[model samples]
Target chain A: MRNVKLTVAYDGTNYHGFQEQRGTGLATVQEVLELCLGRLAGRRVQVTGAGRTDAGVHALGQVVNFDAAGWPIPVERIPLAMNGLLPGDVVVTEAREVGQDFHARFSARAKIYRYTIWNNRIPSPFNRLYSSFWPVPLNDEAMSQACDHLLGRHDFKCFQASGATVKTTVRTLYRAEVIREGTLVHFVFKGDGFLYNMVRIMTGTLLQVGMGKASPDSIRNLLESRQRAQAGPTMPPQGLCLEHVEY
Target chain B: MRNVKLTVAYDGTNYHGFQEQRGTGLATVQEVLELCLGRLAGRRVQVTGAGRTDAGVHALGQVVNFDAAGWPIPVERIPLAMNGLLPGDVVVTEAREVGQDFHARFSARAKIYRYTIWNNRIPSPFNRLYSSFWPVPLNDEAMSQACDHLLGRHDFKCFQASGATVKTTVRTLYRAEVIREGTLVHFVFKGDGFLYNMVRIMTGTLLQVGMGKASPDSIRNLLESRQRAQAGPTMPPQGLCLEHVEY
Candidate 1:
């Protein structure tokens, strides 16, 4: 069996998320890749993605892996075939053979996610749906300071989704920076692993800090409490994107 | 009566087009703007836009104007009100009182349109629905040379849409540039007036020139022919945008 690694990208507008769910009536990046690979291999195949993003969460560097035997088509032709077969919103960027033991989810070392906010009196016309537009002025300095509260390894149970199945709630964050460029604010985070909805909850918390509703020290206290009620509200998923994954 | 000038932006994915048409239930940006103004003025208000962008065409700085007596809200509140009332894809950026004589369509000195082509082998997941992704390699130098053929005032009948009512198809093109940046190929054109579908047709012609299907001299001959058939195929409208209107 030849294991192939793919660099994938997708507009998650119509998807219910990255993973395949029953009765969702929604197409997923995993489902599409599996079907395409199944057709190419002339057998059933399962595609494993690096991360399972929520519905409407976009991705630029989503990775996937699948194994097949005796495939007749050339490796380069895979992208062309997938482009023709897959819907326009999802695309296979790069494909190459990998070691049989290389799993998309298990082999990942780090991941990065970005959340964008159009922080202006008037939201952008073109980016209205893709970005969260807020009329309130954000205190950039305060937001930057709040990012420091979640810089290293910590138990993220307060930020984790209620139904998440991770055995441990601890994760190490390498960097978390809130940057302001022009009329938009970008929240970028790099971490070893993220619990479901953790980034969105963190964003909501940071936004509260920027709006003076919560102090920067509140995040440290909330993390210590490990109670979801102590944390800020969860932000929407449209502005979040799985930017990159490293192995 | 106060004349308000609005700098608008939209994703244009769900609209029929920028203009209101008969028998089409799909909403247009113009229709949405008119509805917002009607509610704000407590009366029906007719809005005139600088350009009529086609279906699925996005915009960043589309200018629009309307006259009203005793607007209920302040000018600063206009953007927020309209954005709250309108759909997620359309937004009003700047709204202010303009001179009584200012007309959106007629008072514009120049207009700029940008046609973006995602010149990459892999279609972007987030931008696939917004941009036209072309897998083939484009010769930017050839495209730039071809743009030189359309630099001055000329009879643009070959590029105009078939149903255009204007008798004189003569228009002055102040500037035309084909630029390649990263994975995007931007065709930017500034002109005094443009015919319906003119920008998309010009993009198609330039794309043909870039692909070595036509020479730079071919554009000159096509313009002289005054026949739409002489030009290349009409490009899809999804990638086109009315960038701005000059006063």
Candidate 2:
């Protein structure tokens, strides 16, 4: 058995999410990837994705691993071969052989998610699929200051969406930042792990701070409360991207 | 009668083109705009587009003019009002009253068109809608040198697609530049006017120069020949954008 790791990228506009909901008849990134790879292998192939990105959430560098039992295609040519079989919205960017011990989800050290916001009064027709539109001008400095409270290890239950059955609500964030370039506001978060809707909730909270609706220090209080109701509204999924996964 | 001018933007993915084709049932940007704005006017509205962009071509600064007889809505709120009626692919960015003599197509003094090329071996899922993908490494310097040949007045019949009925094949270009931004190669062209498929053909010819398939000086020979067969193939319309128009 050969262990193969793949770095994937997808538009995610038409997909339900990255995870496959078996027998639900819903389209997903993982389901499509497995369908194409299974056709190549002439058998069932199980793919383990690093992140279960939500519907309409794009990805630049999502990692995945699968057992390539008796697979003959060389690692280098896998991308071209798989891309031929894959749909236009999904593409395998890189493929390589990893050790048998390597797991795409468990072996991941950290993940970086980036959220894009178009801070303009006029909505962009081209960016309608990829970015969240916020007409009000954001105070990036205030959003930056609020990001400091999210760093380090903390019980991030407030940011976690309801129905998430994770064992622990705690996660460690190495970096969290709000970067502004002209009318575009970008929020970057690098953490050991993120719960369902964690990044989106954090981005929404930060946007509230930027809009002067909430104090920058209110993040600490919200974290201390551990109540999802106290957090800001969940931002749209289109603006959030799984930017990178560190091994 | 109030003559009104509007600047529009559209993704162009869903439209057949900008011009209205009578009874063809093909969706075009002009038809959609007129359908929405005519609803506001409660009568038939004829929209004259500055550029009759081809199918799948985008626009950031497309200009249009129509007669607004006895319309009561303020010019400033037209964008908001029309955008509500228009589909998600098109939006009116700006609208204002224009002189009676002003025409969106005939009064245009200059126009700018931009073509985007993704110069990467691997296809990008995100750029699929807005860019043309080239797998080979491009020599941008060669393309830059080739752009110089397209500057100034020239009988651009060679670049014009066949079956185009025009009184004069001569057009003057004010600016032509090929800029490289990492994996993205952008071609910018500003001219008094452009023939049908002129910008796309020029971009395809320049891509040949970038790929070393043709020399930079071939542009002059193609122009002098006045034969469309001598020039390069027309690039796809998705990468072409009507960036701006000057009256």
| Local error of candidate 2 at residue A72 (angstroms) | 1.6
Q: iRMS of each prediction in angstroms? A: 1.5, 0.9
Query: What are the per-residue Cα lDDT tens digits for candidate 2 across B75-189?
Result: 8999999987888789899999999999999999999999999888788899889999888998889988999999999999999999999999999999999988888889999
Question: How many angstroms is the interface RMSD of candidate 1?
Answer: 1.5
Chain B TM-scores per candidate, in order, are 0.95, 0.97
Candidate 1, superposed: residue stretches over 4 Å from native: A163-165, B163-165
> Model 1 over residues B54-130: C-alpha lDDT tens digits?
88998899999888667778887888888888777888888889999999999999999999999887787666656
Classified by CAPRI criteria, candidate 2 counts as: medium
- Kindly list the per-residue Cα lDDT of model 2 for residues A1-247, writing each as its tens digit: 6999999999999999999998999999999999999999999999999988989999999999999978988889999999988887898999999999999999999999999998988888988788898989888889999999999999999999988888999999999998887878899999999988999999999999999999999999999999999999999999999999999
Best-fitting candidate, measured by lDDT? 2
lDDT of each: 0.87, 0.93
Error at B107, model 2, angstroms:
0.4
